[model samples]
Target: MTKNIEHQFSMLVREIRKEFVGNGPKEISTRFVGSWAVSEMKGNLTNIEKFMMGSKEGEKMVHEARTGLVKKIYSDLSVRRKFEDLAGAAILRIFSDIDIEADIAMTIFVFDRPLISKEK
Candidate 1:
């Protein structure tokens, strides 16, 4: 099941890259962060506990993750806007498939910047 999820995630990333980056030598990268990364980082937390945590804690973590991700994505978008515009949307859509709510939240916050920039 995990393998299938990973495969689906990879395929999603590839499709996003094609839409944004095309077949360029360089690649657009997508990362999962926030509580998801923290939980993975801690390595000892149960999925239930992670999910059961109050919304406040989850929002805080997701905010922090969005800040970091936005910085990185903005830098990438600055240099590769033509090939990375859809990347953020693709990521948000991917998270929608998973049960992790924080992932979607973080993606929403992080994705807005590049999108606004593209419109200008």
Candidate 2:
């Protein structure tokens, strides 16, 4: 299962990189961080058993994370300026292809409101 998930993640990276960089360089400097990175960071916080039991909720969470990370990559001004509008359009295209609830997906991707006060 881990291997399959890793493979899927790699495929996603390749797809996004192809859209963003074409065949120009092996690496391109961009502020758009990979969703896999976000997933890895947050996945540990998510309970696997709970996720399995709450399949619908789990799917929602996963979809939101995917959409949100993509949006962040596309919307970051520094990143967008470097990649041009193609990044934004590519993100939209990817999101459109996904069958998940569109409004919820978009909302999840939109920038979150900043905390008014820092937690101590």
Candidate 3:
């Protein structure tokens, strides 16, 4: 990636963290590859769902929240404008897949083709 692309990608991650990290222990990282931007996050859970991953009800709620997050990212004009140029293409789709292991919540952000530049 060029310097500009790297900067745009970094900004995307920052936006995501700012929107989602809300008073929680969270770790975030991102990468751009083949017209895609991928992000991963591990965050602390609230007491209401402290062992959320281990149960069906908790998992359902988490999945629902992830969908809402994906929607917010797509709908936010600031985020869209920041990425549109760097991508040089419109985003095809955005979604999150999640998992839990050893009491940790992990989320993976998948931006389908056109999320980033394919010029490389």
Local accuracy by lDDT, each model: 0.34, 0.35, 0.56
Q: For each candidate, give its TM-score against the true structure.
A: 0.25, 0.31, 0.58
Clashing pairs in 1: 20-83
Candidate 2: which stretches are off by over 4 Å? 1-54, 85-97, 100-120
Evaluated at residue 90, the lDDT of candidate 1 is: 23
TM-score of 2: 0.31
Best TM-score among the predictions, by candidate number: 3
Model 2, position 73, has a per-residue lDDT of 57
TM-score ranking, best first: 3, 2, 1
Superposition error at 1 for model 3 (Å): 6.1
Q: Itemize residue pairs with steric clashes in candidate 2.
A: none
Instruction: List the candidate 1 regions with Cα displacement exceeding 4 Å.
Output: 1-53, 77-81, 84-120
In the range 48-73, model 3's lDDT, one tens digit per residue, is 55556568877788666755665776
User: Given candidate 1, what's the lDDT at residue 44?
Assistant: 19
* Total clashing pairs in model 3: 0
Residue 71, candidate 3: how far off, in angstroms? 2.4
- Model 1 C-alpha lDDT per residue in residues 1-120, reported as the tens digit of each score: 433433333444445434443421122223433312101111212354356546878745644543454345435544334223323332222121112343322222233233322224
Candidate 2 lDDT tens digits, 5-115 = 434433444455356534211321212233212111111122442354357876677665655655655565655343223222222222211234322111121112221
Which candidate number maximizes lDDT? 3
Q: Rank the candidates by lDDT, best first.
A: 3, 2, 1
Candidate 1 Cα RMSD after full superposition onto the native fold (Å): 13.6
